[model samples]
Target: MAQYRWSYTSLQGKRYIVGLFHGPKTGHLMIYVNSKIVQIDFKVFEEKVYSFFLEEDLCEITIKKDNGSYGYDFQINKEVDTPLNRKRKAFNKVNRNRIITMFVGLGVFLAVIITFGISQKRKKEREKERYLQEMLAKKTVSATATIDSVKWSGDQASFYFKFYEGDIQRARIELIDKAAVDLYTQGLPVLKGDEFMMTYYTYNDSTSLKLNEPTNLQLANFMYRAFEQEQKSQSHLSEEELRCRVKCAFRVSGISGLADVYFQAETRESNPWHNRLTYNKLVRDIPFQEAFNEYCLPQ
Candidate 1:
């Protein structure tokens, strides 16, 4: 084995020791900082001289094999106080400052982008709330009307109302009222042919209207109670079979509007029970001349 050592001192007077070791089949350049091994890589050469630097060119070491011997020759080159060293020191300082400035600028740019995104998100939310308030402030029309039909599409419910306007004119009120949706979802009383008074406001210059008060019709409570009784009495049937039978009964009673509500209530989280309780079940469970009379009869 052959060994060669070179030493360097930085501008701050910190010392670094470097070593080159060669054996029959292996060679490595090693660096030591504060008596601890820092960096190393294997290098192999035959009959040729190799040169390596320590401390970023502060010192250099050259190794050469002897002409007729297995031993090697080592030479050290130390950094001297020359004009070239002065220029190199100045270049290193400028490069370090440039890197620090780049990192600071990048951090500031990322912060600005995150702040802009949050500001835009909040601005959109405020605009949405303002639009909802403006729609609610519109002029309202209150009337007593019989629910002729109820249709549902996506999250919106459209109630067809028959009221006298010189002659009978049909008006559609579409809304996403949470209470009304919850009542229908829970199998509470919501059906065609039900009568109730509603206060609503118009939008799009009277082109559309929506209910804003009394989230659910008052008569729904009576239907809900009758529905519970019928469900309990017919508990023996499977849920799907019960739903099909109830749909048939709604069609027979001329209140097929409830079928739309039933289909809308099906969700991934819960079983569809909106169509499982029908007017036919109420009439079967309670004797009534007509299915609508069962809703008004004493519970």
Candidate 2:
């Protein structure tokens, strides 16, 4: 069977199929045109040329030496080195390169996406492990603190507060970490002589320094507005009824981190939220909103 074949169309629209059968050991060379034998040469060795005519075009098949092996080339009318043929060869080469580049680009994009996904998964796993460790090492206890002193330094202020929780009575200074100065004005919105409740974060095994409370106090001013509205609406009520209205307003406002602010008989001394700067700021102007003047001062 012939291993090499090519098809061509002539200028006059005639079609021809060309095939070559060559035996390297026997040196038997044969050419077929349209399934019929056109040429045969026995004892043909390394190279040979066979030419034929179809219509007005002269076609040539050349078996040439290529490196250590031999190969064949076909051309029509001496058009192998023409400008149009050279341009066609170059265009085909560029198209092949473009196809290869497209596949390579697709592969790189998929690799980047997979790498990003793996990195995100590992980050989340690390975060979960860190959270578990923190939960194991942390201890939370509710405590009462009275603001004994206040000092302002740059954008931050330090508070010397007295904490009395269980059998522990200690004077604490807080919110002065180097990494966080903006958080100073948040949770402990207090002045001298003011008091409030806070959660203490510490370790059971150590008497060392620990966090007093969270510093991200998201103050809800709308609660005070609602309280004022409730006061106005219940102005005509009796004294006890008005007190109930105030209590209701306070309870409703405390839904957001300020829940323990209301005056309960047993817990009144420990819950001085009404005397803190958060409640007193309604009566003071800006820049002095955290002043010591508590308008809703508890007697």
In terms of lDDT, the best-performing candidate is: 2
Encode model 1's per-residue lDDT on 1-299: one tens digit a residue. 66656555666687766565566456555544446665565754455444444444434344445653444444434346555567776888899899989998988998899899899999999999988777676555555556677777776667776544335455655555545555544434445656555554444323232222222453344334433444565678665444444443444432333432333324434534334343334335433234434433345
- Each prediction's Cα lDDT score? 0.51, 0.57
Give the lowest summed-lDDT range of ten residues in model 2: 257-266
Q: Which candidate wins on TM-score?
A: 1
- Which ranges in model 1 have alpha carbons more than 4 Å from their true place? 1-48, 52-90, 113-121, 124-132, 139-145, 149-159, 162-170, 173-189, 192-201, 205-220, 223-299
- CA RMSD of each candidate after superposition: 13.7, 17.6
Model 2 / residue 279 / CA error / Å: 13
lDDT per residue (tens digit) for residues 57-140 in model 2: 668999887664668888885455655557667988899899889989988998999999999999999999999777855675
Off by over 4 Å in 2: 1-136, 139-158, 164-167, 175-237, 247-299
Q: List the residue pairs that clash in candidate 2.
A: none
**Candidate 1: lDDT of 267?**
49
- Residue 246 in candidate 2, Cα distance off native in Å: 2.8
How much is 297 displaced in model 1, in angstroms?
Answer: 25
